[model samples]
Target: MDTIASLFSFITWPVSWVIVQFHKLYGAIFGPDTGWAWGLSIVSLVVLIRICLIPLFVKQIKATRNMQALQPKMKAIQERYKSDKQRQSEEMMKLYKETGTNPLSSCLPILAQSPFFFALYHVLSKIASGDKIGALNQQLVDSAREAHIFGAPIAAKFMDTPEKVEALNASLTDVRIVTAVMIVLMSASQFFTQRQLMMKNVDLTVKTPYMQQQKMLMYIFPVIFAVMGINFPVGVLVYWLTTNVWTMGQQMYVINQNPTPGSKAQDAYLQRLLKSVTQHGEVRGRGRKRVVKDIVAKGSDRNENERRFFAGLAKAGFAAQADGTVVKSDTVSAEAEGGAGTRRQQPKRQTKAQRQAAAAQQAKEAEDATLSVEATPEDKPAPSLEKGPKPQAKGAKPGAQDAADKPARPSRANSGGARQGKSGQRKGPQRPKHPSSKK
Candidate 1:
């Protein structure tokens, strides 16, 4: 353990150096006598570490995707070498090598920071026990020893000292309370951050042993941390809690903006995009290289409502064309016009009552037209069945007719004198023929 501690102290010199810088900066600002300075220095250390590890975080994401992509290959190898454990292991390693993937890359960030974590823990433990240790001289150690955050010593542990045991036996002391609260928070944050990745970001369709292990570790790590937290100094607990908070927030942002294609987070992102399109006539991706649009603007004739809506979309990083198409703000105008062409206008927004009322009005008009067609003869006009051929209505187009003005046919009984025979002879005025023969 001593040899390990020596190695960690050397390996994590940069981290310790950063911590000392923050400690001094905060101490100068808030007085070296206050615990807030020391406690917040630990927080600042976490922030610095996380900022430096961003590239590693991005690498971890790429590695996760690479691992997911290799699932099929891994499964095939497993099936091929099911009878031979050594062969399966060798083949899996070969596959990982070929794909430029590291199975352990997911844990790289934490593993890289482990030495720093332990180094800080050792430094604080020594400072709490009145021993001057690595990078921290006697004067800094004296200040650290005096640093009490919320009445709990910065380096105090739950079961560390005789006074702490007596305080536990007696009543609630600031040391126990602070330690317990920090441990709970740290454990909870770790658990939820891991849980969010598994539930929202993971592609459930690609179920593999690696992901299964992750799921198991999600629960396992929290329990382990909770059990182990009792032995960790309060300063170490603060560091871990701050780190967990940073990870959670970073993960949330990644999930919200650039989630895996088939994950629940992606679905949620799409839903948010659709809502934006509906409300503001456009949607834009946040901090994303590629932007997807669900709506377009057409024509410059926008009213106050549309102008306001589009202005919001523009502020959110959507660009509008002169022809009314909206695309990603980062896209060049030539590309936008080429790809995101003019789209059909969205249907006018209407309330449910308005639609219902319009439908009802149409139905009523149709019913009235049917009733008019079914009118009784008593309601008919006199000219509708007149003997004379009616002239077309003035200014009416050819073939146009009005029901009330249409000409009617002559009655058969009143046209007997002009009857024609089937032999093609017209019998005009048949009474004259009868007078010439024998009436």
Candidate 2:
């Protein structure tokens, strides 16, 4: 059993040795005696990783921008096959191919960072555990043991007993407090960094579902980190906090210097940054303070001009007031006068069928009227037996003739009048004129 245990330890020794080397590397670069050194190492790690992934970041930005630009075309394709699920899927794939934009581009930076993050975690954990001193060389192990910042040793166990604390090189209470503070700062800085990227750096026109997914992850990942932070060792917390601060600063620089135009947060961030830069120098010295005052004076003048322009527009009844209410003349001319309640009256509603029927009826009536107006008098039939009073038998009763004649009179008058006094009047025209004469 002892040999088996020794064998297992030997098998894991290389992994432990690598972690020790990483810790030593950090300690050497950032003085092993100070927490600030470790903090700086964390910052350095972040900077190095970010620099390495710069190409990936650029690709991601380009991909996102391309996706946004293709939104209109994609929407059109969606609309074209809204009811065809299979076709929509095929078309979407084709669109993606044509655009050469992958939805996964945004995650490339995170994917690249994951391995480095894991490595850092391992290094910090090993440093905090203080159990694998045999894996490290004598010089590294001695330096690590001497590593203290503000009287708190980096290798000190935060949950150590009172006796163990006294035995340790630094105050356990202070180490635990520092660890807790670092964890909180780590969580907070990560949240803010991610929040700014999501709210400020993203392009507004990207309607891809993946962009929304990325946004959700941006918020969710930070919250997850915050919740899991408590479990991390103080050394790990220090690294995480420093890394987060670097990320925040990096994001701030990117958003302020190269903001997406349609992003509200990006614009605001840029404006704020510009205001800061114009008024204050890189450092806030007394000279920069005076410069800021001058910038403020210029900003005030521009604001005054804008206010005056808006005021003029408002006075002319062409603009809304600051409260969003439009000002208009209240006086009504005779032509414009109406009942006060009339302005507020709701429009009458019509059902679809009713509206269609009304439209059809109107069209038919218009067509008939137009045909009548276009027809020449000669084209219309002259009054004949069809329209005139029927000829009565030689001894027909007057009552029968009167009843028959009454119905036919109006028709005869209309048709006869349509061809009155024409030189080429046909025999049919003469017959209708003689019928009324006979009566």
Best by TM-score: 1
**Deviation (Å) of 352 in candidate 2:** 27
lDDT of model 2 at residue 45? 56
Q: Estimate candidate 1's alpha-carbon lDDT, on a 0 to 1 scale.
A: 0.75
lDDT scores in order? 0.75, 0.59
- Show model 1 residue runs off by greater than 4 Å: 1-4, 164-172, 275-439
Candidate 2, superposed: residue stretches over 4 Å from native? 1-32, 67-92, 129-136, 150-152, 155-172, 202-215, 265-439
Whole-structure CA lDDT of model 2: 0.59
Per-residue lDDT tens digits for candidate 2, residues 287-308, read 4334334433454343332344
Residue 196 lDDT in candidate 1:
97
Instruction: State each model's C-alpha RMSD to the native.
Output: 16.3, 16.2
Clashing pairs for model 1 are: 297-324
Residue 248 lDDT in candidate 2: 80
